[model samples]
Target chain A: MSYLAFQLKKVFKNKLTPVCLAILLLLMGTVLFMNVRTNPQFSLQAGAKSEIAYRQKEINRQQRLLKHDKQKSKTEVYHDTKAAIKQNQDAVKQDKQVQKAANKGNWRKAYTIMWQQKKQEQTISSNGQDLAGINSRINVEKKLQFFNYLHHEPLPYESQDMPVTGWQFLLQLNQQYLPYVFTLVALFLLTLLLTDSYHQKLDTAQLLPLEKNNLMISNTIAGIVLTLGSFLAINLVLFIVASLIYGTGSLAFPYIVGQYTGGRPLIECISTGSFIIKVIVLQVLTFIFEVVLVQFLARIFRDKLPALLIAILLVPGLNIATMIVEPLRKICAWLPMTYLNAVDIVSGNLGMNYQNVQLNYTSGLLTLCCSILIITIMILLSSYIKYKE
Target chain B: MLTVQNLSLKTRQPILHDFSYQFAPGQFYQIAAENGSGKTSFLRAVTDLIPASSGKVLLDGKPYAKNKRKLFFFESNEWLNVNLTSLDYLKFVKRQWHSNVDLDQELDLLGVREYVKVPIKKYSLGMKQKLIVAMYLVSGAEYYLMDEITNGLDEESRAILYERLNNEVTQRNKCIILTSHYSSEIKVNNLHRLVLHKQKMHEVKQ
Candidate 1:
């Protein structure tokens, strides 16, 4: 066997990589299954209905108050008529003064006097039973008018029916669940690759031809294979679980393609085939970048504890730092984490506008080329150092 | 046959300098030195495991740089992946060398075949050392550069190794060059002993 093949076989024989992949698949499968079972469409419909119902109930309460006030007003109309006329005249005078003061920029003083006058008028109006009934009836009438206005307002959905396409549903499911799966897989593979040698302390490794270089290369290959395989495996398992629960008919390649591309169905969106290819290529590029980054950390730290600590610190720290700096933010967009969020880019949901930037074939190729070049340089430098030792 | 000419090496400080030596086919050479001596550095330089500031090494009258595959170097501490069982490791090494040597019989002769299916992590220091020697023997290279090959071997394993080395040199006509502190145990009529001192090579006779 060639050296590369031997390295690959050795990696497959490792228990860490496989176990990491299994856990990722299991987690994704469980989350996806639960999400499908919960039926988000049902929840959305329920929420809309509850909001409408609450509004209607408020309108009904106001109508009932208006009916009660109408009956009371008939009994007290004659007794309160003179007092009500006098209060209206006083309120109109106060409104004029306040308006003038507001226009002249002495609004604070004017508001104080207007409030005092309104309180005095309210006390005078409440003195007689007929006056009190008239005031209550007027207030209720105003509230009833407002409620009537609301009743004429449009409902959340005019037809009371919202279609939930299988494709849109699946996309939502992936968005909610894929990130945790990817993170867990990355962590598991990194821990295994970084710690395997330290845990075993195998004496034969040092005796191999070009011992240090070989060991480092083997570990790196193992990490990359493990991560990539786990990623593919978890996604495949998710697809399977989704098919089983949602019915395989809803998961035909065309249906998935259509659903992913805004529900145009596969035949209608044949023009999007190139876009789909670009997405796949971008994903592969990001996977490679992630593997290289993990391998570099493993090589530098030489132990699981420090590797994991540095990984944890670096990921969030870089993200936060990237947000505060313009250049770093642009660079961060090309990072592995950013690429893992590639689905957003495909779905036209990026937070920033990339209108002038051509992030098509050229950008994807450039990212892949740069990642490979950096990884190659790191491997060569490491090998040279090992040979020197 | 191997030749070292005008060799100088340093590990943050000078260890060996202006060192020159030569060995013939079927010859057994012992490198002898006290603590802090350059015995290990000289061996490393010859094997090209460490870079020499100024030196040229020739194997069988040809520059070793041109033909590195025919040279084998062994250190006391073996560096094999412990994830693999001993038998699996032997198969891997055998494949790497691309030789038709039987690793099972070699391990048996070394008294380690019982642990062949066990991981190297489970092997004791002496067992691991024996395995290293077995791997070196199976490598079937023209020149064997060994460092402290007998350090952790039992009396029986040590005797077995000495006999194997003797047979490899006399019958197979291979050159065996090694470093050892146990000068009393090794006896050969065609033995050549060299001591590295004061940045130069000095001949030592027993």
Candidate 2:
């Protein structure tokens, strides 16, 4: 039998693999249940009502200031309160319109009303290059894109907040915090599998007639396959379950990826199917890099716990560091850890977040491939040196 | 022939000091040592599982590294991966050495056929011992360095093991060097007996 086959057998026979998978499935199930319970349609209605109530309260406060403050400058107070009431009244009017459309199950009309209000606000407010202005522009462009896309396609049975369709749910899960959770989980599983296959069995495996380096490489390959295979199976199950519960959503749904126009934001959109495929490709590359990294660390530390701890400190640790470190933010396009947020990169959210347009799909693919190649070379070189000595 | 020249092992104190010997094919040699005498350590040092303070082992006057597949050594059944089954281990060893030993015959001889398909973790001590013995026989290496392989074997299992080892050594021209505490229980014929005394090997006259 091939050595990889033997290693794979050993990995699957280990009880830890199944146990970790079970826990992961249970966590996903619970999160899905919670998401279904707090449906977004109801939340939108509730949110609009609250916003109208808050605006009414603010208007009442401003009216009291206009009437009771006799000692203050009367003309300035009158104009300020009048402007405040007008703004609050406009907001209240919009909120009521949104609430009415939401009740009628016509989200497209609500988005059109929102787009008109955003256009009015844009005309009144100066269009500057500030972060808030950029964000507002992006939001406006996104609303228009969604409104246009909805004109051709059927209305999304559910909002993005609580996506009922399979494709939307998958996209939502990736776009939100679930990618981070999955990355951490995959890292944890990789650490365990590598530690067991290499560090714990080094002594016994040394006695094998095969070259030590070949053994290490074979075991590493087996570990990656098992780690990826188990995750792939879990994801398949999730996709099937989600699709069965909710209708399988159209993959042609368009998402605003970025702004193509330089000075003023012109929205660039991609299909959901293409976006998801790119995300998976980038994520698989990232996962391979992580597996090699854990093996390399295990070889260096020569113990399971230290190797696992250090790997944790390196893979996800570096990802967290990039968010807080200013220098790292500027250089995120070159760093492999930045690509750990594959979904965000594909969606252009990470690029926008860092104000660095270079952290996109192409850059991420190059950076991850370079990182994996370099680390794999290092591992092989280290193994050779240790074998020779 | 497998040759050991100037091998020295030490942990806090010396275990083997410049111990040298030449093991030829078609012979069964036994090394007897008391508890804590580094019997397992010697076997480990020979396999290069533990780094020796000094010296090297050679097959046909060449470094063991060049012909690693020609020799097989497993210190004990404890080193086997408990997650794997007996068949997995047997096939692994066979492919590693590129051996042509019949796995079914070896399993039947070692009486491991009953639970060969079960994971090693669930096996009893005796069952694991049998499986290890079967692996060694199936390896078909030129030199076999075993460490107390019969520790948990029953009388029937011991008889089967001795018969197989004798045939492999005398008829097949294979070299067998094993360490054991109970030398008298080894019933193979024309066996070369050696004793570990003062961190060195000395031949014993039968």
Candidate 3:
């Protein structure tokens, strides 16, 4: 085997490393499965039923109004004022129920009911415009209904709830778990890289035919490979577990969003290929950052504990600093840990208008290019310094 | 063959000044000095492990920078990763050297074959030292630069290493430059000794 391959094999053969990686994968899978399972969109017991009931009520009211108006308008003038009043009453009753649900802290039920009622109104009025008298009546009726719901509904359980898109779920997982994995794995590998040499008395590695720079290059390659392997393994395990608990293929984007978001028309977010690309990019970038950090630490300390500590301390502080300092934050955005958190590039919160910035295929390609450049530079410098001695 | 010309090194102060040395093929040279006499520094400088304030090391008439793999340096502490077994360690060296040597034979020679599959961390200091020598032998470099080679070895292990080095020099015609406190054990085979004193290298014959 080539030296690089040999190094990678050595890294993988270690029992603890793979075991730790497997455990991490299991944990991530459990979290993702739980996130999918508890999602309000997938809950057949609550949101779906309320939505259907609300729509049926709205449809019944509209049909009653239509029947009353038709009966009155058999001859010359179509005077259906009584029919319109009954329609308004039905709308008012639906609005009151929504208000009651909201006030009772059943925000999911309220939102679903309100959404269904709005949808029913739109569908009923799709044919043509009503007279001024009828239009005014409907308008006043909707306003009063809305008012009653808002005022009377017990402000339903402050459902800080938004539909969870697949990308969002992955993003959340990355934010909470990726850094921990990256930090731990990087430190573990780096420690073994630096201290193991001393412990094994293999100082001859430094004296090998390879330049100090190349040796460092070898280490960096080893580190990147190990980190990537562990990361993939963890995610794969999570994918399997998610598939099992949520039903087969539920871990896939279309099904995942369908389960959580009730297969809403706006579920387009999870179905796009761009979402998967974003996730992969985020993972690659984070892995690169960890590799670079480990390389730098290994070169500087030449021992495991100090290097590990420095890495641990630096990541959190850098994250906080990136948040507080604007220019620095942009720089940090390029950092793996920071990039991991900022993967919601489409979320529009990073102060850059993603649309205006033309963040599409070209930008993604540029980011990949930039990542390669930074990683190359870091590996070169690290190897140069590390192998120097 | 290895040559060092006008090599000077300093760390916060001058360690060696205008030091020069030459070792021919099949030569076993000893670098002897008192504590802080720049013996290790000279070896490091020659190996390009440390930056020499001024000088150049030549291996086979080419500058050391031109051919790094041909020259191997061994420090007192073996820098193997502790998690690796003896076999794994040999495998790493073998990969670097691209050699097909029987590692089991080498391990047996060093008396470490029994621990071949055991992690290096479990080895005693003497065992670790022997393993270092085994690694240097396996590296197959043209020039071997070993610093404090016999620091932690027991008598038996030391004897085994001495016999191996002697055999390599005589049989394979490899050049070896080593430093050691055990001057008596190394005073054999017309060894050329370089004594470091007053910031200079002085030649001595034994």
lDDT of 2 by residue, A63-84 (tens): 8887776467467867887898
Point out the higher-scoring one by DockQ: 1 or 2. Answer: 2
Give the lowest summed-lDDT range of ten residues in model 1 chain A: A154-163
Worst 10 residues of 1 chain B by lDDT: B74-83
For candidate 1, the per-residue lDDT at A222 reads 65
Question: In candidate 2 chain A, what residue range of length 10 has the lowest lDDT sum?
Answer: A259-268
Docking class of 2: medium
Off by over 4 Å in 3: A13-16, A19-44, A48-172, A179-184, A187-206, A211-217, A249-274, A296-316, A324-337, A346-365, A378-389, B100-102
> For candidate 3, what is the DockQ-based docking class?
acceptable
Query: Which order, best to worst by DockQ?
Result: 2, 3, 1
- Clash count for candidate 2 is 0
A-chain TM-score in candidate 1? 0.53
Interface DockQ per candidate: 0.13, 0.57, 0.40
Question: Candidate 2 has which clashing residue pairs, if any?
Answer: none
TM-score of chain A of 3: 0.57
| TM-score of model number 2, chain B | 0.95
- lDDT by residue (A1-389, candidate 3, tens digit) is 45566567568666778777767766766666566556755432254346556656666765666576686666433445445556656665666666666556675566565656655665666444555544443444343344334334423221112223433345555556665565666567655653444322224355555666666667767877777877766655554454454333222222111111221111112322445565577556556666667666665666667767887767655665666766664354344444444344433223231112332323434564576567668757655664443
Model 1 gets an lDDT of 0.58
lDDT of 3 by residue, B1-206 (tens): 78788888896678889877778878788888898878877877776666788887788888776677676776665455566677776777777776666666787887877777888778888778878888787778777888897888888878878888888788878888888899888744546888887888778755
Q: Model 1, range A233-296, lDDT digits (tens) per residue?
A: 6665665666665543222222111111232111122122344455566667666666666666
Assess candidate 3 and give its TM-score to the true structure: 0.71
Q: Candidate 2: where is the Cα deviation over 4 Å?
A: A42-110, A124-158, A175-180, A197-203, A209-217, A258-268, A325-327, A356-358, B10-13
* Residue-by-residue lDDT tens digits, candidate 2, B53-103: 998888877877678788887776656778889999898889989999888
Best by DockQ: 2
